[model samples]
Target chain A: MTARRLPSGDFDVEQLTPGVRRPIKLRPWLIFAGVVVVAFFGLIFSRVSLDRSGFELDDLEEQIAIEEARRGDLRVEVARLQDPNRINAIAAEIGLVYPTVRIEIEVPGLDVEGIDPEFRWAQLKAVLTAQP
Target chain B: MVLGVAFVVAWAGIGFRIVRVQGFEADKHAERGEQQRVRTEALTAPRGTIYDRDGVELAVSIDAVTVTANPSHMEDPAAAARLLAPLVGVPKSVLKERFTKPDSQFAYIARRLESAQAQEIRDMVEETEMAGVYFTSEPKRIYPAGDLASQVIGFVRDDDMAGLEGLEWKYDEALAGTPGQQIVERDPYGNPIPQGEFVVDPAQPGADIILTIDREISSAAQQILAQAVKDYNALAGTVLVMDILTGEVLAMVNAPTFDPNDRSDANPEAYRNRAVTDVYEPGSTLKVVTLAAALEEGVVTPSSILKVPGTLEVGDKEYTDVGRTKAKKMSVAEIVAKSSNVGTILIQDLLGNEKHYEYLSAFGLGQVASGDLPGEASGRLENVRDWCDTTCGPSTAIGYRVDVTPLQMASVFSAIANDGVLVEPHVVREVISADGTRQRYEPTERPVVSEETARVMRVLLQGVVESGTGSRALVDLYTVGGKTGTTEKFVPGEGYSEEDRIASFIGIAPIDEPRIVVAIVLDSPSGETEDGSDMRFGGVSAAPVFAAIAEAALHRLGVPPNVR
Candidate 1:
């Protein structure tokens, strides 16, 4: 690079290479504003989700309570229906009476001693099935 | 300069106040705010259910509502009382007086109303735009079987559901569960706040109990006993049917029983389980013990003959056999069949007091026969040392100078039926916890006699039912055996009444394969039977009851007829 003097008695220089450009720098306050805006929206979204879940949970709990109450009523109804006195009264109204005598019929090939009645019945059933 | 200094001092004072509040009193203020929103509530645990052997609900608990009123908020106390009178089953005057009480903020309109009734009242109040009335849910105990086994199952208090009688009082602790608590946040309108403080400790339900009672057999026994009480013109009666093998009580009935559902006019006297609570001199029924002791001690055999006089005098008390006036030679079996008091006293002479007391104690006298029942009498058996050698032994052998509950007598018969093993009787079959852990009842057993001796005693007892005093206790198509007991009614603060008598019969059915022991006790039976038989006698009054109950129970139990 070489320099030349001007007529105004100041030192004059001549540039031989091209001029270079510098990079731009960002502002700190603007970056901070952007971060605050994003955080505010995220907080709102989370709170909305939490409230919706709470309402759903409340509805489910209420429904369970109602169903439990209905189940309890049904159980009570079942118990009342099985009342012995009521059944006896109904039977009497329907002209039903206990038999004075109970007759037991003996089946052939089924009279084994020391065997359970259920087992004997099963054996009789098998014999009848085989005959058919 | 003075104005600047004043402003500086004022700022300094304000700054000091701010620091004091934010630093020192912050926790106190925060706690105060929380107190306004957070609430602690009690959660009640449900009471256990009582089921029969067949899993039938005998006593149950259901959610019911209680109605309350803030009388101060009533606009027209008279109109409100009139509107609620019929609905609440309370008199209008009573309700009005309660509503008009000065400065009264709260009053119970009715407690433990059924759900349907509460709903009706709620609808009426809403339609009429009536104020001051509110309803809260609570538990109410109900008996589904009505008066089937009221004396055995008992009843609970109306307000707190606490047990007051019978098995309810015996197993109250296991049936009432632990309560729990919850801390929650709420808004001003009593609505729960979302995302707020929530903590809960869930309640544990009470353990359920399954009893050994059979509903069908109990119903049959109750009907039979009630009819006997009415037919004989008796004051009261009790019948017990027990499974000798398992020592499980199949039926326990008390006549004049009240329904636990509606006890507003119930007689408190009828609330007692007389089978276990009341004691009486066992009369001729106790002769089996003397005979059993003689047989077990090898003092006599069933064929041994004794010369019995018409009457015997000892310690100024004369003992005589009923319907016998001449001295005769009778075998041991014949004496039991005849229920001869003189013959039994002679047998007691053979077996001394020490041996007799040993057999009585071995047969579960002088102690509670079963721990399952509440208020069960141990029966009066004087110590051998206390027995005055003169009349004590003779009176005791003739069914005097001793007291025994019907349950104890039944247990005595059960021992014979169970092959001489005195199994402890129990009503509770099992207890199932809320978590499904089961604790089953295991009865304790002790041998009272050898199997052969028990068999011989059973045969001798059979002679009584076949043609002897207990002939009326014979069941059709089933061989049965029992002893008749008739005692003069002894009144406290008064001597024995000649007019009143206590008749009882304890029997075992299908004697060859003994399954059940039925005990019947009739108190103060009067009026003879249609055939002119004395109603005050055990053979006439209580034996027939035993027959009816035994037949029904045996049929229900599916015990095939063992006799042609």
Candidate 2:
């Protein structure tokens, strides 16, 4: 310890102590705490990602199921509309009667053209083009 | 020193146990843990859809639900049974009996409930906090066309979705797809653990089928058959419309039919696809085959003259004409037009027994049509060597001793319509797999007769519809060629009955360029019309049905009318 003089002859003391030397020791508790914090956040991150993916998978599954059900419903509706008796009744209601007059157009080799393999492409083209 | 020794002994014991548990017993404990966390479930695949030629839905499989339960998980079995009985449409007593055994692990509450109905039950269960009830997705068959082609399309088994009849049964292997499996981790409440190991194997859906039937034509055919059955007061009826060129069965309908969707009330007899499954004597329709054979062999021409008689003696039995007219000189064409029994017998004698049998066999008689339909009968044909009856030759010629399905009879006429080619008749045209691969079937063709002979027979048949027995079969804007058949139904162990008659007609349209063949058969049709007029003859009863069906079918098929 050393003492220094202040103004007016009053002594202000200054103490000088010798530096003490100590050995470095490893603290397992601090390491453990750090590891636990990192692990907790990692687990949270993974759980959030997993939950998001799972929800997406569930949504896609629900969508597929809904689509399949809709397709079944549409098919049934289409068939109902195509019913012949219903169409016939509708036609009758609209005053469309069956034709009574007979007409035949005589074209030479007409039957052969329908059966010929070489002419099939032309017929198919005509049919496709005829569709509205 | 003694305390130290005791402590060391205890330490050794502890270390040994740690080694034993960590090394030797690890696999067993790990397996036990996995079993608790892992579950295996079956993935349900959807059944196939069936469509008509024009992409009309005929049969489809819709989403459904099946209710199942684990009895051990049920909090109150008695209460559960009471709650579920009415919802599942089962008897309360039966449900209570099922719940009596506590040891029972699982029970089925209901199967194949509609989606809306199942959803209501599920919501109720959840709201009531029911513990044991569970639902599984299933598929139920729906025939949107109802009884339109019921016998042809058939129905599937409720539990396994297996086909039981008709084309469904025949093509079951091609229709049913492979099932899949999945392994997933679930919690105690059966909810999937999102973070746990989850593996999935997706199910593969079944193939779709496209049929050769035209819905419009088929519905029209069904309408005609039903009306014929009602008008004639017939017990039942069958009709078939075939595309001559492709040998595609455009329409096949049967009266006394049942809807496959509501099979609980369907009659067993109504399940038969009578066109290919039932056999009857074809009567005068067989005469066309006989005439074709005779003409092909040059034994008779269209103008070949024959001395016709009212009755022809065959063995001890007499084959008499229906009209009992005096014997007159008539051409072979007149014989077919008049449907004279004695004239047909004369024509058959020219071909003799062996040639006639061979021709009949060649025309697809006495053979299975090999259609993709279950329970098709190979109509009865006695061998030439088994001709024990002295009247077999003449009787078979006039369609009495032999039996033929309407399908076979139609094919015979279709052969002539198809320019002498006898193509195999089929209903299924294409099969589309789940993977979008398509397989189309080609019709098997066989030369039944020469083209020249077929044309000549077509001309002769045209006479029958023009001014003869089948005049009623003529359409308004189209020419028709056909044969009228009226046969006495044969009784078991007895001869042909006089009261019960089968009136039938098979007609080809647009005679110059044939496109469709319509065949109609009315079983035991009454002898009176709605106007109280006598209408027992095929020319009167069956011909008009054929006319109406063929007319509509031709119009729907887009075949232009041919008239000269």
Candidate 3:
């Protein structure tokens, strides 16, 4: 340690330790107060978000219940519409009656003609004519 | 020094309390706090739906609202009743009387209200600021097809919706699902708490059921049976239509049926599925069985000749043909076609007691047609050991001593239709669970007779429908075979009711291929029509019903008509 005097007669003291060193002052209580304030605000923000999400979950659940009720209503409606008696009544209302007779047509066997050039052309033309 | 001692004692008391709270009382306090917030809620699972073979909904469960109230908490009973009377469809006086009970903790205002009705009532109650009124979700059973197959589908009780009859009662457990529970922590005002202990046990839903019934055919048969009962002025009627191949009961319909939806107007008598539940003498229909047994034993052929007298004697009793005068030599097929009692008794006499009893047992007599249906009567077929005193042989031959259900008789014809293979009659086709797992039902089958004998029997039956007793049962554009039955109703105190006769006809359609068998029975049918036409004979009465139902069923199944 060394002391030096200026012209104004004020003495300045200096530390001469090996290597450059700076004396730093720290207020631990202030740092701790800053961290505590940050943490408290974060907790409040988190609680608000959680409460908001909880309300959102409740709303979603209520929506799901409503959808289920609507689905039940639709199912009941489908069942009502598919009733056979109703179908019969509607058929009768449309002036449609049950068929008293059923008929089935039998297909005749086919016989092939000669397959020359003119005959093939004639077969193709016949098919073309049958398209409509 | 004295003041210092008192301060020390106070400090010691505070320290002791802190230790007690932090140690032994801590768990107890924590449990009490959890109980204040944690609530157990029930999770209800939906019941299964019932469908027909082609996937049409027959019965279904729908959500409904049950309105309940704590009567003691009601501010004004009269006002509450007045507000809810019309909405709940309950009389205002009844509601007032129920709500006026001051000490009652809970009472049902209404059960199974429609969605709109429940919503209206809820809004009204909220608008009035009524207290202690609550609504809960209830599962309600609805049969959309109404009375189409009411007896087969049956009805469930309003309370708890438990099955009370028919297939509903038989497969109740399979259709009812398990309820689950959930426990979650809630705040003081009943809101769920975030980051709280929550647990859930999910509900397991019930399994669905698919029946073997054809809805269209069933509806058609029901309508035909109803019209028949009305037209003939009969007490009741039943029709059983089944596929001969798989023994699937397509339609089992009964007249005078009640709608299960509004069960208050339904009669308990109409609840019985007559085809399976009621028993009656099968009359001449059983003659086919006798002839079949005789042919199966190689004792007679279709062309075999038999000396059939007008009257035949057995023990001390005499059985006579309906309208015969003298002895006649007739072929076995001719005898069966005529439904001669003397010929059937001769066949029964040749079949003897032991073979006859064995044949009856083999034909599914004295046993229920096992299936999902409940309350089946096996009918009365006495064993030969207990038949010593009775004139069992001749009487049973003429279908007098034995009693059989319409289902059993239909099955007998179905056996002949299916080439002598008697398959068990069943209603349920498959049971499907919520997870898409299926449990299918396989029918039980047994061979009743040789195919050759069945073919011969088919030939004999064709004669009956073509030119014999059941000639009126002929269908256009198809070959038909059937047997007619006209039996006197047996009374308990009396021997038999001469006025009340059960007319029935069991028929197999498209006899060359034999796809379906239909049996129809009319109880106490009028002996004469309104125009003085005779309607007493089974061939005249029940055979036409058989024709109409068979025609509709065959067309619905897309069976091509091969007109002869």
Candidate 4:
């Protein structure tokens, strides 16, 4: 091996004497250890965020599923309430009459339903509360 | 040495074979593995949309959810059924029975759910883990304009939700688009994996239907008829409104209609489109046809004088006058206004039965309108040959044994309204494809009578509405022209029931321009009095209905106030 001069202007000829010992360098190992510790903490934080976001997505999807079901039921309800014979029969039972239009429904107390001031106010309140 | 050399060569050959097999099969094995994990997407066709003539939405389909289950996957089948019973509207025992075999793959746990119910269940699902339960997207049809124009629009079926009546039945194929397909590869666990690069086929949506029905005009006609039904105390009624110029029916209504969206509260009879299907012997309305035939054949003129008597005796049978009044000399127009049986029969004898048949055929009698319906009736016309020897010819001349649907009679009047041109009644405007491509249907026309004869007939009819039996059908804003038919319904063994009578009236509006033609018929009226014992005239019952309908329909159509 060719010897190179150091800043100390010294070059070693023998590798080491069996009896003679020197301390090990700690700079490279320490730098590598520091990088690994920082990487481990980053991984822990990332894992926590991924779990939390996945749960939120799951909750939103579940809510969407419920909404879809509700819409289907509304279809059934509209069909039921607007039925001609049913409405007419109800009107007859309540003695409510209608104009000649073919698709009219009359429930009992139809006039009251239309003109009752208290009922109208209740309707207004219901609308404000999104209950109607 | 030889054995060692042979072993070395064999080992090298074995090594090459292993590399060749593993390298070549790598792609094939990977593809097979991916297939096991892939899932398929099941896409259903979207329902078609319904619109009114004026670009208004009447019915539409909305997104929904349905819960289905694989009974075999449930660890506790009984428990699962009990849990799902309330949501599905089924008994827990029934669900348990379904899940008993465990071989039954899919059981519908619950069907279309409302938003609230879905929310409650979804909340429950999250609050409590309900595994092995799956939900899919479904669609439910909704009618925004509930029950409006229901008789014409018809209703869909319960099972497949197909249009079974009215325009719903006519353009079903066009409204229901061809369902497309999406073939998907599913895993053994039925879990879906999106093969992002794989081919996926989207479903074709149904085309939009455009009906020739005018909603406002229809409602207006209905309102008028409804009032008549009430005032007259008639059993059931029908109102048909048609554009005289185009022969396009603006609205046709039959009482006791059903909501298409909810068919549970409906009767099978409500599905009947009485405008074309129900036929009755059009009493005096038939007299107009007889009168038209005589005039068309030059057998009689408008000013021709007739010597009228209280009763006319023919072959030992006597037909009495409507009011038992004394004999009087009257013009042909006066005969129509007074509805004189003798006047009509005298002309019938002059025109001959053959001539009468010819006129009836021209007026769209003895045949169906041949519309979109598959089973339209021919209405009963036994070819004049079946006339009951003694009363046959005369009775027919006075409107008997010849059943006529309200629509057919309306078409005849519409011909008179349109100056002798008969136009076929059309409902469907176009048949469209899934991709918005459309094939249009044009209005069809045929000349039935001479313009001269039609003009004379119009004058006679207007006189009837203005001063005769149809005076009840007069509209204040416009001059109306029409005829009334009141006939006693014959009971088989009872001859003619005292109370059973069919009252009918048909009218044309704005006699100057002739816009709409309407007809109303009431069957089997109940109320009877001694003073007005024979008061079951079309004027008292059907004529008022015609009036109400004409008034409402004109207002709805935005007819300018120029009906002089």
Which candidate tops DockQ? 2
Q: What is the Cα-based lDDT of residue A23 in candidate 2?
A: 45
Worst 10 residues of 4 chain A by lDDT: A101-110
Pitting candidate 1 against candidate 4, the one with the higher TM-score is 1
Give lDDT tens digits, candidate 3, residues B302-344.
Answer: 8888888878767789888877969999899988888888988
Against the true structure, candidate 2 has what lDDT? 0.85
Tens digit per residue, CA lDDT, model 1, B484-539: 99999999889899799999999999898999999999999998788899999999
**DockQ (0 to 1) for model 1:** 0.36
Q: Give one digit per residue, the lDDT tens place, for model 4 in B1-564.
A: 999999999998998887776787778877887667554555656667666666455566666567777877777888878877886778999888877764688877676654565555666666667666777656666666566777777656644557777766766676666665555555475533233224467767777877677776665666566666666676677888888988888788877566776877778777777787887888888887898778877888999998877778888777765875687888999989878887788778788877787788878888887566544677877786665656667878988878788888888899988988999876666656677688776777898878888899889999999888888788876888898888887666877667788888888887777899988887765564344644367777778778877887787787754543
Candidate 4 chain B lDDT trough over 10 residues, lowest sum: B190-199
Q: Give candidate 4 misplaced runs (Cα > 4 Å).
A: A1-132, B1-44, B70-106, B114-120, B127-129, B188-191, B196-198, B223-233, B384-390, B490-498, B528-535, B562-564
Candidate 1 residue runs with Cα over 4 Å from true position: A1-56, A101-132, B1-29, B68-110, B119-135
Better of 2 and 3 by TM-score: 3
The model with the greater lDDT, 1 or 2, is 1
**What clash count does candidate 3 reach?**
0
The candidates, ranked best first by lDDT, are 1, 3, 2, 4
Looking at model 2 chain B, which ten-residue stretch has the lowest summed lDDT? B527-536
Q: Higher-DockQ candidate among 1 and 4?
A: 1
When just chain B is superposed on the true chain B, each candidate scores a TM-score of 0.91, 0.89, 0.89, 0.84
Q: Rank by TM-score, descending?
A: 1, 3, 2, 4
Tens-place lDDT per residue, model 4, A1-132, is 799865552645344346666778999899999999888888877877765665565557666765655554565466546444355567779989644443322233435645787776666565556622
